[model samples]
Target: MTALKRRGTFAYFLVLVTMLLVWPMGVILMWAYTPWSKSVKVAITICLTILTVLTVHSVCYFRIMPS
Candidate 1:
């Protein structure tokens, strides 16, 4: 039963983390698409790319390797 509870809690934590991650990606993308300057767009694009890579790494770390 304890393992079940832990698993449930972990699932909730993953959901929460995913939700948290979605907000920033959405926000950055929204701004990235707007009629902004090229430099600003490039900066956010770089940030978004880096953010995407990091998020993928995080998911692999948390979801793939965990017992």
Candidate 2:
């Protein structure tokens, strides 16, 4: 069982935006301190995982041509 804290709405939103836009490592690190719920944390992890995979896919497929 994990101990949860009481962080306000702003912190919650910050974590969310951090999860979406910031580096995935940052979000993963924040999970230890942030007071967001388990579900929210899970959602963040899922979203980051999906986005990272997509990002990797895009990078792999991207073609650079000198014109």
Name the candidate that leads on TM-score.
2
**Which stretches of model 2 miss by more than 4 angstroms?**
1-22, 64-67
CA deviation > 4 Å runs, candidate 1: 1-34
lDDT over C-alpha atoms for residue 39 of model 2: 94
Q: Summarize candidate 2's per-residue lDDT along 1-67 as a digit string, tens digits.
A: 3233334555666666776577575577568767668997788688778888998888777754334
**Measured by C-alpha RMSD in angstroms, how accurate is candidate 1?**
15.4
Residue 64 Cα positional deviation in candidate 1, in Å, after optimal superposition: 2.6
CA lDDT, candidate 1, residue 60: 86
Error of 1 at 13 (Å): 31
lDDT of 1: 0.64
